[model samples]
Structures are given as C-alpha cells and as structure tokens.
Target: SSLTDKIKLQEEDKSENKKIKSFEELEKETRESSLKTLDDYFKFISELDRNDWFGVFVNAISSRFDPHTNYMAPDDKERFDVSISGKFEGIGARLQKKNDFTEITELISGGPAWRGKELEPGDVILKVAQGDGEPVDISGMRLDNVVKKIKGPKGTEVRLTVKKVDGTIKVISLIRDMVETEETYAKSSVVERNGVKYGIIYLPKFYIDFENKDSRDAGKDVAIEVERLKQQGVSGIIMDVRDNGGGSLKTAVDITGLFIEQGPVVQIKSAGTKKEVLYDRDAKVQWDGPLVVMVNNFSASASEILAAAIQDYKRGIVIGSKQTYGKGTVQNVIDLNQFVRGNTVGDLGALKTTTQKFYRINGGSTQLEGVASDVIMPDRYSHINIGERDLENAMPWSKIDAAPYDTWKKQDNFEKALQNSKSRMALNEHFQLIEKNAKWTKERKDAAVYSLKLDEFKKEQEKIEAESKTFKPITDYQNDLKFKPIPEDEVVMQKDESFKEKRERWFESLSKDIYVEEALNVLDDLQAKPVTKGEINLKKKGVKSK
Candidate 1:
C-alpha cells in the first residue's frame, strides 16, 4: 500500500494523479505559504485538488500495521491521535454525511456544542466561520477537513450557519473543549410493572483499553452495578446492549464471567487452527437471578461476545429486534513506524486488520447472522434490510458445539413461563400500541416525498406533534431540544387532526414501548414466585411499580 505505487499507477493510467508528496512537503508548503496551526493547515489542505483524501488516510493508517507506524508528517499525526483517543478539542457533536451536507447527528451531552442550545440533531451546517465576515461554504467539502475546521481550542469559537429540523435557517456559535469518556459504557435504571421491580442496564458500547491498564475498568464497574441492583432486590435484570459496537476482547470475556460461574465465554477459531477457549477466571456468578438482555442491529464484537456467552450458558434471555451488528472479527492495530525504519511517516497510525471471528460455545458465529434473540421486538430497521447480510465481504455464519454450564437448569420451566408471558403481552394494550407505532414508523420511513414547502412540511410536522401527545416524552429529550412551553391554543389543537389522530407513531414517537412493557411483565412473573426458603430470614421490602 505504498503511495508511490498508487501515484505511479495513476500516472500510467493518465488519470488525475492527485496525491500529496509527503507530510513534510505538504507542511513545508503550508508554512512557506504562512499557514500555522490546525485551522491554517486544514484551510491549506482544502485548497489541494484531491477528492479522496480517504486515500491519504488509508495510507497513513496502514503504517500502524507495524509499532513503527509513524505518519512522519506533523498534521496527519495530530488528526490520527484525535480519532483514536476519541478526544477532540471541539464542540461535542457528531456530524454525519447526509444528503450532500454534514448533518448534526446528536449533540453529545455536556459538550460545549450541546450547550449552545442552537445545534441539534437533524440540523445541517451550511457554512463555517471563525470570524464575523462571509462564512466559508462547506458544501461538498471533504468530511475530515470540514470536521478539522470546526474543531479548535477550548476558548475559540466556531460559528455555524445551520438549517434546523423545523426547516428554518439560523447561525449558532459554540466554543470547544476536549471530550471525555471515549467509549460509551453501560448504565442502569429501575423499572416497575404491576408492583414488580426490574433493573435495566443499558450498555451503549464495550470498551477496554488493555494498552492502558485503567485505574478503573468498565467491565468490572458494570459487574458492580449489576451486584448493586441485586442488593436492591430487583425481581429481574435486563441488560440492554443496543447499538453497542464493542471494544476490548479481554473485557468481553471478563464481563461474561460475571454471569456464568465458570466456563468458556467464547471459542475463537483462528485461520484453520484449533479452537481456543477463553474461560472465566472469577468463578463467581454476580447475579444468577431472572435475567434478560436487550440487543439491536448495532450491537457487535465485544457486545456479541457477552450476549453469546449469556445465551450459550442459558444464563439470560436475549430480547430485542432480530440480530445484533454481526461484527465478530477481532482487529489488531499494527504500527508501521516500527517496521519501516528511517521512513518519514512518523507513527503511521495503525492498520486495523480482522484477525479472527468469534463464536459462541454452541458453535454459532456472531458474524453475518448475529445472535438471535429469544424474543423479537418490532423495529423499523427490520424492514429496511441492512446489516451483515447486505455487505459484500461479510463472513458467513456458522455454529460449533455448545459449552457446558449448570446454573439456570434449576429454572427448567423458564421457557414455558416465557411463552405464557409473551402470549399475554401480544394481547396487552401496551404491546398493541407499540405495534401501531411500528406501522406508523414504517410509513414515514418508506415515504418518498419528503418536502420543505411550509404547507406540506407543517402538515407532516403537525401530524408527528399530534401523535407525540399520547405519552410523556422518554427521558428529557424535550428539555434537551429546548422545547418552549408555548401557550396552548385549544382552538388550534381542536382544528388540527393531530390531537385526535391515533397516538401510535412509531420511530418518531415511542407512544408505547411494548418491549419495555413486556419486560416489566416478565419482572412481575419473577416476583410472583415465592421467595426462596432461605430468603425469609432477611428483612422484607415492598416492591415499587410504574
């Protein structure tokens, strides 16, 4: 993956050979032209005639395939470090390539960008400016450079002209700072239904930095959280692994050990070799109580590893919409700087290569076919048909022999109880509401004619607003959105069909969360069972219901 080879091939083909010489040459040109820091460096780089700066990134990353990985060039090295550390001196917001514009995905909570009160998800930034003059139109600009321009020092302000979700245009100004907590971790909450209490833990991502032996580890912390909930006397625990794109392999093994007493968590079969077993070291079951795990299309890797282990051990019930992210490959960062001595590329970053695919003890590979849940929930992603199944180079799903564990066997009738619970839920009001919402979401997602004309847009927005009135907003999204408490117009609410319309809008409005409701029901079942014979000696506590 040499730049010379790429450039030579381009030249021989008589195609546009747009490639920078070396980071040194590029920086020399920038300095000779009087460019200084990141802002100047990026502005200068933006002037270069290259559409696929992705190539430059790829080459730079390849250097990491060996520890000698050095980009040699100063600017590229800075950018590389930021991406890996997941820390950047900028507004805490995620910008995505959306319809020829960098759309704001979500304002990271507690970030300076989110504090601006003007930036929001679905807002599109049309222009960026450091000063008050005419803004630099970033339309069609490379995503990397566009991001570089927006990120700056803690006190420096970056102005952004944006198109809001309401289809109005405005300018938002925000100062920047470093982002903490690179990887999302698991968080827990309590839920109650019919007087039964349940503990819910939402795991956003599995991250373990073995390179930096943390003073505190996420996996151990999560295990502690589970134990705390058990002490609180939850009837059941629901581990939510939705959108968890995974991190450390070792951490996944350690986390799974908390559920199963002592057994292999995941079996790794590398390139036609013997299968290697990763076993639990703790020999302690943190919470052997009634358990369920939640997953979605985005849960993969370490997330899959934990999920598969739980399922294989029959330690918990896997619940959610279909399969997970189906990413079971392990990647190691190789540093090229270490290998290619005297090469100018500083720490050439790293090359993340897929080394092995992991499988459950039962022989199922969480590759293309992610771990199938014990119960399925309705999701818009189900109909859209995206994931490992759609990818070209995706690995195929397979199975292996199941591993042995002997904890949940005591609750042999759990499946029958679960089936009975599911049947009851299908006829429940909350489940029906979620079904209606799912249908509504499918319609909106499938709509082909999304428009901005006031009448048309307002009609759509009004419909959504009306549907949202059925249930209180989940969490504090309304306040986060800076929703103002405008005086209610009874006449307006009456004149519009929004209020009277069915309150079952799906993706946009979670009027009824059937999965959560069902989960609560399961919790109730766990509670209905008599307290263990030995548990009566302890003081009793009344259960809280929601």
Candidate 2:
C-alpha cells in the first residue's frame, strides 16, 4: 500500500469505534499485505515479454562469473554511457517522484532548462509534450517513463507543463542539448592554515569520454586543477577521492602522474597473459609538494589504483577509512550489435564483462584486500561489512613480483607527519564518538529482528533513539576552517547563481569537516621546517619585521 493509503486506513480505523488489533491479527494482516504485494509483482513479471526475460537470463548467466559482469539493455547502455562520459542530451533537470508528482530536484548549470530560467527546483511536472505534439498528463506515471518522455536527441524541443512553487501552472519549452553533470567532474578549493595555503582536489570518479579524445577527462581536469593550485602558490595538496567508486583506468594513471615523476602506476593481468605495467612516461610533475589522498570504503578500482600508487611510491599519505572498496578487476563493455551483420532486431545492448585484474605497483591486488590507509580514521562504517570483500563472488587477493619503482624521498618528515596524524586521531573526541556510533550501528544492524507490536516497538525504538541522541554531536561538530573557490571557479560562480549555490554548499560542508582539518594538519607537518624552534621563531619574526 502507498503511504497515503496507509494513512487513510489509519484515519478510517480511528473514526470507526473498533477494538485495537491484537498481535496475531496485526501479524496476519501484515503477512497478507506482503503476500498481496508479491502477488502483484509476480503478475507484472508474468506479463513481461520474452525480450525482457531474455535480458534477465543473460544477466543471471553473466553475473555467475563475477558480481561486476552484467548485461545492459538499450536504455541502460545509454545511462551507462552518460554516467561515464558525464554528459547527456536532455532537458538538464534532475527529477524525483514526490508522491504522485515528479518534482524538479536540480537544474544542471549551463543547460537549456537552467539557461531558460523558466523551470526551477520544486516545480511539479504535470504534463510533457514532444515539440508540438499533444501533452500527456504524467500524474502518477513512473519517474523513468517521465524521464524518457522528456529526454531526446540534441536540438529537439521538450515542453513541460509544470505547477510552480507559487501554485501557478505554466508551460515551459526547452530545447534539449548536451548537459554536462558538473558533480561528475573534478573540482578544487583553496584553504589556508597557519599562514600556508593548501589545495583540495575532489575527484568523484575517473571519468572519460571514450568516443571523444579531446573531451574533458578526470586526468586532464585534475592536472588543470593542480596547475591552478600551483598558480595560487599552494604549499600542499589533498586529493579527496572519498566515496569515489572509480572509472577509467587511463584517467587514474594520468591523475597519479600529476604528483610523481615518470613511473609505473598500476599493473594489469589477464587470465593467461603476463602482467602489463601502465607507465606514466611524462616526467613533468604538476604538484610535487606535500600530498595527501583521502579515501573511504566506497573508493574502488581507479581510486584504489591512485591511492596504492601514491602509497607505494611514498608520494602521499592515504587517510580515512581502514581500506578502500577492494575492486581490482577491470571490465570492458562489448557492444552486442557488432556481432550481427545488417541486423534488423532492435538494439541488443552491451555486455560489461571482466577482462583483467589490476594490481598496485607494489604488485598487491586491491581485490579482497583494498589499499589500507596510512593513517586510519574512524567513520560510521568502521564496523560494518563493506567493500569488495563483502561480495560473495569477489575476486581473491594476490601478489606478484613488485614493479621496479623508486620511493619519493623529498619529504624527510613523512614518518613524523604520519605519527602526528595517528596521535591526533587517537585523541580526537569527535572521532571517538564516531567510533562508538559505528559499533552501535553494527550492533543494531546485527539485531535484525524487531517487535512488531505497537507498544513494544515504540518502547524499543525509543530506547534506540535515546541512545542515538548521544551521538548527535558527531554530526553537529564543526571545525574552524575556511574553504574558498579558486579565482576561475569564483568567476564562473558569479555568472551562474546555481553554480555559486553549489560551491557555497561545498564550502559549508568543508568548513564542518574535521577530516579535512586533520588532512591540513598532516600537510603542515609534512612541510620542510627549520631544525629548531628558535630558528622557526626567528624566521617568523624576520618575516614580521619585513
């Protein structure tokens, strides 16, 4: 039943003078409701044609090899392409189903919808029309079907009849165009601590356009961001790949090359082939200063590669969760249409199958065992089962002969800096609370059974909620740090209000991030300093005197 239905049922029960449901009666009703839902789902599945069943069967077969191997239908393939490429031809607005209506969540900056300034976030989409075609009332329609009706080839027209936030109905016309998902790209910010500036580059994924060589890729964009930071005279850089689930392998190698001199980034191995080492032949170091890479359990594949390479070379300190997502296998999408000559059967879609496995330059596979952080930090998922190891059919961890690579020796205080971070993490109260919360979360997750009786359930939930209230400070805690956009981003933000809002929100989060504060502290420790306290004080006095 829908939420509204459930609420109406409760109201009806209250209006009618009826005895409260007994535990057995409630349990029987709950079972009947669940069985009804299942029956409806099976009925829908029974109505599916052979093509849909064939796709499901194919996916089931492919998944048997590994969890990552799967089939993509035509529409699914389109979505996959957009995700990796970070661009799509559409109305450029994100939508969510709010009850029976589709609400606009966000308008992609620089896209037609944003440029028009007619459709805004919170506007409920009522009807959709293709060019001058008849409008179709989409009330209670599936969100995906609504999206299909709205998205089209570039240069086409999409007319949306939306109910505005002010309770006014208006028809907005927008020409569908190539919309780039800004969050998918690399972005950077500058922060100052103790009279030294540091750069923070957040790469959500190793995105690339396989069809377009000259397009923006994570590697190129990160290098650009690094150069921008260099121009700002930053003393250190923090590469934040936390929650990044990985993307292109080449982009990972390219991004890693920005920090170190020419070296092997990662090694690849096929089923029956010798290992192939991907080398960064470019000797030009974009940011050779003190470096730190931030990651969490969601960071996988390309993210692991970058972190592992940096760790192996002693290029940077990896901080955050105990380990990354541990996905080492590589996949290649094979277009199934290529096999048929002059095919008439609609698009057969593509198959993403594991082709090879990637290992760190140190020759250790980030499969079941991901890259362990140099300085482990406490997070909510600390005690939870996560990463590739959690998957039943995940690949095994292995090691081969270590690739010949030289460790970076520029920072003499590397060990000292790591120790300082570990000491700080040990003593931090916020982190301690976070660790406690993680244990509590794991305990709650393990205690799956719950009382279904209203009074008993309420009491149980109240007890849990009361305990959780103790950890509220973990979310409320904020560090006294300021993060600002670079001049280039600032200029862009000034022209685009939506972009400005997004950057400001990012800045707000950064200000509250204790992890970022600690990262900067580590960067400070990694700096080459005077031998003695007197000399450091003397240098500071001399600068003040000047």
Highest-scoring model, TM-score = 2
Cand. 2 Cα-lDDT: 0.80
Candidate 2, residues 115-158, lDDT tens digits: the string is 78688655789878899885666775656678989999999998
Tens-digit lDDT string for candidate 1 (137-182): 6766667778978988888888897865434456688877776563
Clashing pairs in 2: none
RMSD each, Å:
15.2, 9.8
Q: Give residue 360's error in model 1 in angstroms.
A: 1.8
